[model samples]
Target chain A: MWELIRANKRNSIVLMVIMASVLLVLGFVIGMVFFGQEGGFFGLMIATTIWLVLTLISFSSGDQILLSASRAQPITHEVHPQLFNVVEEMKIAAGLPAMPKIYIINDPAPNAFATGRNPQNASVAVTAGLLARLNRDELQGVIAHEISHIVHRDILFVTLAGIMLGSIVLLSQVFLRGMFYSSMGGSRRRYSSGGKGGGQAQIVMLVIAIIAAILAPIMAQLLYFALSRRREYLADAGAARLTRYPEGLASALEKIAGDPSPQLATVNKVTAPMYIVNPFKKAKQIKLSNLTSTHPPISERIKILRNLSQGASFNEYSDAYANVTHKKTIVPVAALSTKEDVPLRQASAEAGSEERLDKQMRQVGDIIRRVNQFIFLTCACGLKLKIPPNYKSNKINCPRCNKSLDIPRK
Target chain B: MGTSILIVFLILVGIPLLLILFVIGIYNALVRLRNQVDNAWSQIDVQLKRRHDLIPNLVETAKGYMKHERGTFEAITQARSQAMGAKTVSEAAKAEGALGEALSKFMLVVENYPDLKANQNFLAVQEELTGTENKIAFARQSYNDQVLFFNNKIQMFPSNIIAGMFGFTKRDFFEIEVAAEREVPKVSFS
Candidate 1:
C-alpha cells in the first residue's frame, strides 16, 4: 500500500505539472493575441502564480468542497448504529488511524465515494439510495472499498488531481466561450484588418489559443482517466480481503450499475471519479484512448471479485485480478498483504425470504430516517409531529392541540 | 570537454548516493514491518479486552431469568478472570479459548429460559458479545497474518539481509488449542 501511495503521488505530481504547463502555454498564446509578443512572459508568470495558489488551497480543503458540493450531511453513531458498526469493523480490519467521518447524500442514486488527504482526515460519503438498496454484507463490501482508497492514499492524489482537472476544465470552458462571443462580435476581422503589428501574428496566436482552449481540458481529463484502472481493482481486492466475501461486493456492483435511475443530482464531471460506481448513468464501456477508462468496467471488477479461489487475501486477490484483467502483479511485492485467505461465507438458508428483504429495507429506511433527523414527538392530542434534524427552534406549537412542545438539541 | 568532465563528476557522486538511499530505504521498511506487527497485536489485545468487558453485562442480563445456571455463570466468570490475568500471547489464546467455551456453554444453558431470549437488553448484549467474538477472531487472524508477513520479510532475500544486520527475530503466533477450535477444518482445499 505504501508503494501504491508513492506511485500514485508520483502520478498526481506528473499530472499537475502537465496541467500547469498546458495552462501556461494557453496563457502565452492568448497573451500574444491580446497584448503582442511581450505579454507571453507576463502570462506565464500569472499562470504559475494561479496554479501554485490553487494547488495549495485545493490540497488543504478539497475534501470539504467536495462534501458540500454533493450536499452531503454529516452522520453520527446515533443516526445509524449499524452503519457505524460496519465502518468500525472495517477500520479495525484495515488498522486505520481514525474512523473516516461518514456522510450521506440525500440523492437516491446508490453510489458511494471516499475523499481526504489521508486516513486520519478521510471521510466517506454514500447516497441514501445505497443504504436503501444494499444488504448488510454488501454495505460492508462497499465501505471496505472506500476504506481501501483511504489506506492506499488514493484519496489524496485523486482529490488533488481532481482540483487541477476542474481548473483546466473551467479555464477551457471560459476561454472557449470568450472566443465564441468574440468571433460573433467580429473580432476575427479585428485581428486581420487592424491593430498594427498584431495583424498576422495576432491571427496565428488566436488560432493557437482556440486550439489550446479546445484541447487542454481533454488532455487533462485523459490524464485523470488514465490514472490506473489498477487502483480501482486494487481497492476491490482490498474490499474483498477486508470482508472475506467477494460476492457481497460483486452483487453490490451489479445492483449499483444496473439501477435504472438518472444521474446523481449533485454529481458533475469533476466529482464523478470519486464514486465507487460513476454517479452519472453512462454506459460502462466508454473507452477514450483505447488503453484506459475512468474506472475499469463494473462487470470486470465484479468478475475479478467473484474469481477469488482460495479466499479474499491479497495474494488470492492478485491471482484473481491477474486472471480476469490478464495483467501480472499490479500490486507491489512489498505491499502485498498475503494472509491465509478464508473461504467465502456460505449463503444463508432460504427461509423468511420476504421477511428478510422487508427487514433489510426497513433497516435501511430506519437508518436513513434516523440520519435524516426526523424527531418524534407525540402530542397529548395524539398528533405526531415530525421535525427535521436541522430544525433549530426551541419550541413548536402542535397543530392539533395548540400545545407548545419544547424541542431539545440533538 | 566541460560537459564530459561534469558527467564523470555526476556519476562519481550519484552512484554512492543511490546506494546509500537504497540501504536506508530497506532499513526503514524493516522498521515499518516490525511496527506493523506490534500494531496488529494491539488490535487483538483491544478486541479481547472488549470481549472481557462485555461478559459481565451478558451474565448480569441473563441472571434474572437463568436462575439455575449458576455453575455455567461461575465457569464463565472464572474464565474471564483467567483471561484478564493472562500476560503472554499463548496464555491469552488459551485463556480466551476457555472463556469462549464457557460463554457458549452458558448460552446453551440460557436457551432453556425462553424469557431471557426475549429480554431486549439481553438480546442486545448477546448480539454485541457475538460481534466482539467475531472481531476477536478476525483480529487474531490478522495479527497472525501480520506476524507471518514480518517473518517472511525477515526470511526473504534482500530484507533478510537487513534483518540479520539489525537483529530482528521471528515472533510467535497466538496458537489456540481447544476441541471446537481444532475442528474448524482447513479452508484451503487446494
Candidate 2:
C-alpha cells in the first residue's frame, strides 16, 4: 500500500510538472503574439497567478463547493445508519485516520465520488438512487472505492492537475475570444504600422500562438484524463483489496452503468471527472480507446473486477486486469510484490433482501423529506405521516386512523 | 599528501554518518509499523466491544417473542460474557467464535417466530448486529494484514538486522480459533 501511494505521488508530480510546462509555454507564446516579446513574461506571470489562486480556492473549499453544487445534504448517522456504517467499515479497512463526512445527493443517478485534499478531510457523497438500488455489499464496495481515492490522495492530485487544466483552458479561451473581437476591428492597421521584418516575425508568432491556444487545452486534458483513467483502475484495485470481494464492486458497477436515469443535473465538466463513472457519457457506447473520457469504460472495469477469481490482493487484481484487457498490468510492481494473499469472504446475509421497488422509492423519498426538514409522525395505525415544513394546519387528521394529532412545535 | 588526508578523513566520518542515518530510518519504520499494528488491534477491540454491547439488546429484543427459547438466550448470554472477559488476542478470538455460534443458533431459531422478525425494534437490532459483525470481520482482516506486514518487515533481510538491534518484537494475529466462525454468522434479517 505504501509502495502504491509512493508511486501515485511520483506520477502526480511528473504529470503536474508536464501540465505546468504546457501552461507556461502557452502563456509565453500567447503573450508574445499579443503584447510583443516583453509580454511573454507578463503572460507567464498571469498564468502562474491564475493557477495559484484557483489551486488555493480548491484546496480550501473544493469539497464544500462540490457538495453544495450537487445539492447534497449532510446526513447524520440516524438518517441512514447503513451508509454511515459502510463508510466506517471502509474507513477501518483502508486504515484511514478519520471517518470521512458523508453526504447524500438528491439526484436519482446511482453514482458517488470522494473529495478533499487528504484522508482526514475527505467527504464521500452518494446519490439517493445509489442507496435505493444497491444492497449492503454493493454499497460497501462503492464506499471502499471512494475511500481508496482518499487514501491514495487521488483527490489532491486531481484538484491540482484540474486547476492547471482550468487555467490553460481559461487563458486560451480568453485569447481566442479576444482575437475574434480584435480581428473584426482590423488587425491590419497595426501590421502596417510595424517595420516589415518585425511585422513578419509578429505574424509568425501570432500563427504559433493561435495554434498553441487551440492545442494546449486539448493536450492538457488528454494528459489529465489519462492520469484520471489510470487512477480509476488503481482505485478499483484498491477497492477490491480493501473489500476482499471483487464481485461486489463488479455488480455495483453493472447496476450503476445500467441505470437509465437522466444525467445528473449538477454535473458539469469541472466536476464530472471526479465521479465514479463519467457522468456525461453512457457506459454502453463508450469505447476503451476514447482519449478524453475521464473514466475507463464501465464494461471493461466490470470485466476486470469480475475476472478476479484468484483473490482480492493487488497482484490478483493486476492479473485479472491483464487477463481481461489483454494489456500490461496497471498496478505498480512494488504494490504487487508485497501484497499478501487476500481470500474473499462470503456475501453478507442481507444480500438477499431485495426490497420492493416502491418500498425502496418510499425509503429514498423519506430520506429526501428528512433532509428538507419535514416532520415525521407515526400514526397509531402504523402509517407514517410526513408533514412538509410549510404544512399550514396545526391539527391534521391521520388519513388511516382519522385521529387528530397536533403538530409538535420546535 | 594533504588531499590524501582529507579523503581519508571524509571516508571515515561520512561512512559512519550515513550508516547511522540508515539505521535511524529503518528503526523509525519499524516503530511506525509497530504502532500501526497496535492501532489496528485497538480498532478490532472497539468493534468487539460494540458487538458485545449490541448482543444483550439483541437477546432482549428477541426474548419477548422467543419465550420458549431460554436455552438459546442463555447460551448467547454466556458466550457474550466469555467474550467480554477475554484477555488476549487468541482468547478473544476463541470467545468471540463461541459467541458467534451462539448468535447464529439464535438466528436460526428466530425463523420460527415471524412476528419477532417483523418487529421494528428487532429488525433495527438485527441491522446493528449485522453491521457490527461486518465491522468485526473487516477489522480483524485489517489487523491481521497489519500484523503480517509488520512481521514480514521484522523478519526480512537488512531491516531484520535493524529490528534485532532495536528490540522490535513480532505481533500476533487476531485469528479465529474455530473454523466455523471464520465464515461470519450470516445475520440476515430477511
Candidate 3:
C-alpha cells in the first residue's frame, strides 16, 4: 500500500502540473489577445497567484470546509463506537499511522467520502442513510475503499484538480462575458481597426480567444473526469487488497448503486468524485465509454469488484476488469509491478441485526451530543450530570452525591 | 563567454546547494521512517495492554461455574503474569504463544460445562477477549511490517549511507512463535 501510495503521489504531481500549465497557457493567450503584447505576462502572473492561493487554502483547511459544509459532526468511540472500531480495523489493514477522524451527516441520503491532504489529516464522512442501509461487511468494504483513497494520495490530487478546474471555468466565464459587454459597446473596435494589418490580426485573435475561452474549461473538465475514473478503479483494487473480501465491497456497491435516493443535500460537482458512487442517483446507466461524468458506471465497478473472487492483486483486477469490460490497461503498468497478490478468502456473509444498528445509531447521537459541547458526568449515586462543553467551570458538583468532579480547564 | 560563465556558476554554486538539499531530504525521510516504526510498536503495546486488562475479568466471570477447571484457571494466571513480565518482542512472542495454548485448552475444557457457556457475563467477556486477541494479532502484523520497512530503509544503498551517518539501526520484527496460532496465521504473500 505504501509503494502504491508513493506511485499515486507521483501520478498526482504529474497530473496537477499538466492541469496548472494548461490553465496558465489559457490565461496567457486570453491576456495577450485582450490587452496587446504586455497582458501575456500579467495573465501568467494572475493565473499563478490564483493557483497558489487556491491550493494553499485547500491544502490547509479544505477537509474541515468539506465536512462542515455537509453538516458532518465529528464523532468519537464513546458515541459511535462501532464506526470507530471499523475505522481502526481499516487503519490496520491500510497500515495507516492512526485512524482518520470519523464524521456523520444527519441526512438520510446514502453517500460517503474521504477527504484531507494525506492519511494523517484525513476524514471519512457517511450519511445516516448509509448506516441504516448497509450491513457490517458491506460497511467495512466501503471504509476500506475510502482508506484506499487516502493511502493513494488521491484526495490531494482531487482537491488540487478541483481548484484549478474551478479557476479556469470561472475565468473563462469572465472573459466570455467581457467579450459580450465589449461587443455591445462597439467603440473599442474602431481604435484597433485604425491600423490595417494589425486590425486583421486583432480580429483573428478575438475569434481565437472566444473559441479558446469556450473550449478551455470543457477540456479541463474532461481531463479531470479521465483522471478520477482511473483512481476510483485503483482505490477499489486497494480496498480489496486491504480487506481480502472483494465481495463485501461488491455487494455494498450494489446496495449503493441500487439505492433509490441518489441526491445528497450537501454534495456538489467538486466533491462528487470523492464519493464511492456518483451522488447523482439519477444517472443510472453511466458507462465507461461515456466521457461526460466523473465516475465510471456503478454497475461496472460492482461487476469488477465481484470478479475479484479469483484473487486480490493488480493483475487479477486487470483480468477481472477485462473479463467484465473486455478491455485491458485499467491499472497502469507501473502500479501493476508493485502490487502484491493475496490469497482469496471464501465469502463470510454475516449481516448485522437491526437491534445492533439501533444501538449504533444511538451511540452516534451521544457522540453528536458530545461534539456539540454537551458535558456528561457520572455520579456515585447512579445519577448523570449533563453540562455543555462551554460550561465555564474548573469543577462541577455531581447533582446526586454533591461530590466535585474535575473538568479540564481550557 | 556567457554560456561558459553560466556553467562555472552552476558547478561552483549549484552543485553544493543541491548536495546539501539532498542530504537534508534523506536525513528527514530516515527520521520519519524510524518514527513510524516506533509508532507501530506502540500500537502493539496498546493492544497487548487491552488483552492483559480483559484476562482478570474473564477468570473472575468463569470462576464460580467451573470448580473442576481450577487447574486451567491457575495456568492462565501463570501465563498472564509471564506475558506481562516478558520485556522484548521475541520473549513476548514465546510468552504469548504459551498463553494462547493455555487459553485454547481452557476453551476446549469450557465446552464440557454448559453453565459457564450459558452465563451472560461469561459470554460477553469471551466475546470481548476474542476480539482483543484478533486485534493483538493485527497489531503485531502491523508492527512487523513497519519494522521491515524501516529495516529496508537503513540497509538500502544511498539512504543507508545517511542512515549509518545518523545512527538509524535496524529494528527487530514481532514474530508469533507458537505453533497453534502460527500454523493458521502465517504471512503468506506467495
Candidate 4:
C-alpha cells in the first residue's frame, strides 16, 4: 500500500505538470483568438495567479475544511475505544510513525474517510452509525480501507482534481462575462454602415462563449470523476494488500452497499470520493445512465470485491464486473448469523422463561467462547496459557504451578 | 509560431500551476501526518485509563488474599500514580513499565492464595486488565507508525523541501527504549 501511495504521488506530480501545460496552452489559444496579443498574455497571467492562490489555500487547509464540512468531532479513547484499538493495530501493521487521530460524526449512516496531506497529520473519521452497527472484524476492514487512502495520499489527488475543476468553472465564467461586455462595447462603438456583419460576428462569438461556459465545467467534472474512480480502485487494492484479508473488506463493502441511507449531511460532491463507501446514495428512481455521476455503481463494486475474495485475479474481478447483472441480492439476515449463540452461554441460565431469547443467548455465548480461544492469558504462576476446547472440565490444573482451577463455564 | 506560443504559455502559466498543486499536496500530507500522531497518543490514553480503572478492583481483589503483602500493594499504587502523573511520552513509557512490573508482582502474591484466584471479581478484573494491556500495546504500535510516516515525510525529498519551508519538522516516535521496559516482571509461585 505504501509503495502504491509513493508511486501515486510521483504519478500525480507528473500528471500535474502535464495538466498545467495543457491548460496553459489552452488558455493561450483562447486568449489570442478572443483578445489582442498583450490582452491574451495578461489574461493567462491572471488565470495562473488565480490557480496558484486557490491551490495553496486548498492544500494547506483542505483537511481542516473537509473535517469541518463533514462535522467530524475529535474523539478521545473514552468515546470509542474499539475504534482506537483497530486504528492502532492497523498503524502498527502499516509501520506508520504515529497514529492518526480518530473522529466521529453524529450521523447514522455507515461511512468512513481518512484525511490529511500525509499520515502524520492524518485523521480517520467514521459515522456514529458505523460504530454502533459494525462488529469488530467488519469495523477493522472499514478502518483499514480508510487508512489505505491516507497511506496512498488519494486525498491529494481528489483535492487537485477539485481545484482544477474549480479553475475551469471560473475561467468559463470569465469568458462569458468578457464576451458579454466586449459585444456591448462593440455595439456602442459601431455607428451605422456594416452593422449587420459586425452584429452577426458578435452574435457568433456570444454563442461560442456561452457554449464553452456551459460545457467546460461539465467536461472538467467528468475528467475529475474519471480520475477519482481510478483512485478508488487503487485504494481498494492497496487496502486489500495492507489487511491481507480481502474478505474483511469485501464483507464491509457488502454491508455498505446494503445500507439504504441518503448521502451524509457532511458530504458534497468534492469530498464524496474520500469515503470508504460512497456516502452519497444514488437516487433509486433514476435509470442507469453513465451520463453524469462520478462513482462506479456500488453493486458492481461489491461484485468485484466478492470476486477478489474468491482469490480471483484483479483482471478477473474487472472482467466479472463488466458482464455481471446489476441485480441486488436479498441476503437473508438469518444467514448472516454466525456464532450467534456464543455470548448467551455466559449468561446465568436462571432468568430464562423466553425460549427464543435463551436460544439466542446460547448462540452468543458459543461465539464468545470461540473468540476466547484467541485471547492470550498470563497465569499468576508466570505461565502463558492457551485455553483448549475441552478445558471446560470441572477441575483443570495449571501445567506450571500444579494449581487446580475451575474454568468459568460460559 | 504556435510552438513559441506554447513555450511562452508554459513559462507564464504552467510552472505556477504545478507549483500550486505540489504545495497543496505537501501541505495536506503534513497535516495528515500530524493528526495521526495525535490519534496514536489518544489510543494510549484510552488503554491507560482502562488499566487505571482496573487497578482499584485488582488491589481490592488482592487485598483479601495478601493481607501481609502491604509493601507490594503500596508499590503497585505508587507505580500507578507515577504512570498517571506522567505527562510526556518518555515519562509515560517509564511509568507504565513500572506499573506493569508492580502489577505482576501483586499478581504473583495472589497465586499463593487459592481462594483469590477462584474469586469471580478478581478473575474479571484480571481479564479486563489483560485486555487493556493488549489495547495499549496496539496503540503504542500505531503511534510509532504514524510518527515514522510523519518523520519520513519531513526527511524525504520534494515534500521535505516544502515541509522545511513550512517549518514542519520530524517528530519522535513514542517507543520503549529497553527490552526490560517492555517486560512485565515474572512472578514466581516456586
Tens digit per residue, CA lDDT, model 1, A64-120: 988999998898876665567777778877778788999988877899999997889
- Give lDDT: candidate 4, residue A382: 71
Task: List runs of model 2 lying over 4 Å from the truth.
Answer: A283-289, A351-357, A392-394, B183-190
lDDT of all predictions = 0.78, 0.88, 0.79, 0.66
Candidate 3 chain A has its poorest 10 consecutive residues by lDDT at: A342-351
Per-residue lDDT value at B2 in model 4: 92
Candidate 1 deviant stretches above 4 angstroms: A186-198, A260-262, A283-293, A325-352, A376-410, B1-27, B61-78, B101-127, B157-166, B182-190
Across B1-190, the per-residue lDDT of candidate 3 in tens digits comes to: 9999999999999999999899899999888878878887787788778878888999999899888888999999999999999997788879988987888788878878878876757866775665566466556656666677778778888899999998889898776687676455344588
Ranking by DockQ: 2, 1, 3, 4
lDDT for model 1, on a 0 to 1 scale? 0.78
DockQ of each: 0.37, 0.73, 0.22, 0.09
TM-score of chain B of each: 0.87, 0.90, 0.87, 0.86
lDDT of 2 by residue, B101-126 (tens): 88877877988998998787897888
Writing each residue's lDDT as its tens digit, candidate 4 over A248-312 gives: 66767777778776657877766776787767676742674654556666666666655553433
- The TM-score of predicted model 1 comes to 0.82
Q: What is the lDDT of residue B100 in candidate 2?
A: 85
| Candidate 1 CAPRI assessment class | acceptable
Candidate 1 shows a clash count of: 0
